[model samples]
Target chain A: MFNQMQLDILKEIGNIGAGNASTALSQLLNKKIEMNVPMVRILSFDEMMELYGSADKKVASIFLQFSGDLTGNMFFVLSVEKASTFIQQLPGLDQCSFVLPPYSEMAISAFQELGNIVASSYLTALSEFLRLSIIPSVPAVSIDMFGAIITYGLIEISKVSDHAIVIDAEIKDPFSKDKNGFIKGHFLLLPDPDSFQKIFSSLGVNQ
Target chain B: MIENGKTIKVGIADMKIAKAPDKLRTAGLGSCVGIILYDLHKKTAGMAHIMLPDSTLARGKTIHMAKYADTAVETLIRKLEEVGVRKVTLRAKIAGGAQMFQTASKSEIMRIGPRNVEAVKKQLEKYRIPIIAEDTGGSNGRTIEFNPENGVLTIRTVNLGIKEI
Candidate 1:
């Protein structure tokens, strides 16, 4: 079960993970694609979908997934138009209109590769702190929240556990210019029921 | 067009179909569903590019009045009926429900694309609206055009099914 200190450890682990993710993105995008410190919250499915209303679901699901002592998931969503625009406008990226540009094989591969880097970075960060090797299951990428993507992820995670702590963050760099810089994200942890109760106790204690 | 209106009419999201100038209407949508019902003829055309099926479950902002396959379809039917579209003229043309999200979630979890499609079909049937045309189930999201001017529904997604449903 996770306590205040344990959650802090998890948060630090997430911080490192997302930091690594941003580094990979900067390199991949060939620009200073910066990411902000992630905001963390534990939520039910409905709350999660509500947040997406602000984004564009007509796009595909771009995110990363990590699991070990904890699970971290992130979404880099874009509306179909925005995704096409981003990919087309993705400065350093090539403009290969292979059938559908954003939904092409290259796009999914690139997205998965990004997910791997970001997810691995979190595992790497968590390992550095948790001192335990954390290898995530293969990243599960999807089109949008529309299909079974969102529900299934929640179902799968909730089946194995009780709660997921989601971290939301915008991917932007004030220092440089990456207009295509997106809102990438990562998760701090998704603990079991025991862990959730444990964190609940800690939250009360901290307050 | 409403200039920073509260209406969020993104693809695969909320879609409202009305004639004249209503605050809630998006002319361009694809892969998402296109709905039409006559509130007077009682006719209404509503479409939601729902990427998911059930709102009772999921993570990170899953519940929008316009994003669920079940809610949007049923809501449109009821609203049109309330305005007076008879159940017969209420025959529908639905499109979109593309597999926009193709990832481990498809292989590992339920296929929401098909789920939403089937859910809409079932819901529409419950109202006895024979689906006259349906272009759905694919990998691309959709753009739907509903002319409240004539109640004509035109849906355009990508690849797979590319006809007016």
Candidate 2:
């Protein structure tokens, strides 16, 4: 449970990190990118699943494990279509074979590179702002059902608490919108239940 | 009304039971197991979407009974018994426990899908419930629907399409 001021501060922190990530992505693709203000929600696990819509939707997700001063899981989720668009942007990567099962080596590497850049950019900004040392592991790319991938990220939290603190940032491609009316993806940060107090206390919010 | 054959949905860390002309379902089982119990004679069914292996792992003040394999199996059986379904007639079916990311295998949490499956099976053994069928342990997500009338469990996955066990 966070006070109004603490919630506001968290939102602001998320926004700052998202801004840096968007900048990195825009430069990589040479396109205009729009970043939404980060939305922070403390939701029950079931509610979070409902908010995500059906768990069966296919997605391309990059997972990164965080350690150091603050420990948690981070994920960057993109629709398969959005991922294909990124692959199309990169020259001459369309013709590679046998990387991960069902995914070409080129696609997997592209996603991993993209994930690393975006996640590291976000972390760098947050670590500087919060003055905490945060180190992110190498990104792992996967294409799977949205629910399964997210469940993997949330298991550590679900063991101890029914509710999860979800910090979400939406990054959109201003020039190219998909049939879904949005060519956007999500950057999610899920802190373990025990880590929430450490984060807030380190930021000097004791209440 | 049981006339419409309505479907009862069990969310993650939740449980439910229903009778004939009705079904129990759960979606997006990554590292979680969907355990179903059905009695052919009564046409009654129960389901729990379990997220963790044990209740002892809980650190919160409130214990979510349906979230752990150890408690979920017990809670579901009691609910079915309350509805006049005999525990001796109950049989089990399970699905969904996937390691979604391959590179994450090095960490303990990444193996939770397999662990959940093992825990669920162990709990069923403790209750003397015979497991009729199971579709578990892979790197994929699954949505499962259980029909008590025919005692059929349908598992849907993005990669493997659909299969009935």
Candidate 3:
């Protein structure tokens, strides 16, 4: 049950998770970055089904895994145009071309590295906040279909449980990790409902 | 683009761009909703491009700080009032509410355009400001520019292939 306390707990959890995610993405990009997590709320399945528009394009999709001490599966969906935007902003990859196929491997590596960082950081933060340990499964990266990618995660997580808590966090990707940087990326946190509450409570907010 | 005139570049969702006649001449609008609220009486034009539906969901105050439909419209009206724009004389023309990005899920987060459109319409009625014209919805981003005196609206889109919905 995601009561008031739970919402607060989830918000804090997202902040920590986003930090970890930023660390990972920053390393891969070889540039300092920051994450700005937005407010988290528990939505019904119906709400999730509605509201969002369809895919803008089929070119590039960003994939990640959402794992915690509890249970949940979630993926990140981004367009190639967006990915291009991200890559273009990311450092080191400055030499990389925006072309496809050959760049696919580079893109996958970036995604996986980001996944590992965020997953590890989220679990680590949740464990510290709850005083429990969590280990995320190995992340698999690919570039095919957005529907297929999101659907696969939804199914994989659903198989283990029916009820899940999602934390919709928006991260601000700063070109430089240090101060004097503008927000350039969004970091989202999708957690299972149970743990989501615990984390929210810690933030001192009603769930 | 640089010029003697002031150009306030409005961003996605609930940000208003306003400048005095000798100050602002152009304001850029994107996929997000842009409510061009003007006062013919005062010759003042104020624009707000909001991303989300309401500010209730927001955490804190933003720089431009018109995060919600109701609040943004209210603020614009208040500003116009200060500049000697009469309430009855105030009118509006809205543009940009494209579903720039679509997904099979169709989450409420993306339907922001329609929801924002509705929110703005409701607020306008509450303020008693007549919406003379509006071009919203569909799947294309738009750029709108308005000159306070002439009150002439120049609308443009990215033209990503398909016609705007």
Q: Chain B vs. true chain B: TM-score for each candidate?
A: 0.65, 0.96, 0.79
Computed on C-alphas against the true complex, the DockQ of each candidate is: 0.12, 0.63, 0.02
What is the number of backbone collisions in each predicted candidate, taken in the order shown?
Answer: 50, 0, 35
**When superposed on Cα atoms, how far off is each prediction in RMSD?**
7.2, 2.6, 11.7
Cα error, residue A100 of model 3, in Å, equals: 14
In candidate 1, stretches whose alpha carbon ends up further than 4 angstroms from where it belongs are A1-14, A23-34, A40-61, A64-72, A76-111, A123-137, A140-166, A171-207, B1-36, B46-75, B104-110, B143-145, B154-165
lDDT of 3 by residue, A106-134 (tens): 75566556655665665676667666546
* Cα lDDT of model 1 by residue, B1-165, tens digit: 443323324333445555333223332232335454443243344444443455564444334555556777777766665656555676666665555444554343335456667877887777787777676776554445554434555544343343443
Please name the candidate that would achieve the greatest lDDT relative to the true structure: 2
Model 3 per-residue lDDT tens digits across residues B16-53: 44544522222223234678887655667788765445
Instruction: Quote each prediction's TM-score.
Output: 0.60, 0.94, 0.47
Evaluate chain B of model 3: give its TM-score: 0.79
**B53 in model 2: Cα distance from truth in Å?**
0.4
Model 3 chain A lowest lDDT segment of ten: A48-57
| Top candidate (DockQ) | 2
Q: What is the DockQ of candidate 1?
A: 0.12
lDDT of 2 by residue, B22-98 (tens): 99989888888999999988889999999999999887788899999999999999999999988899999999877
Q: What is the lDDT of residue A173 in candidate 2?
A: 85
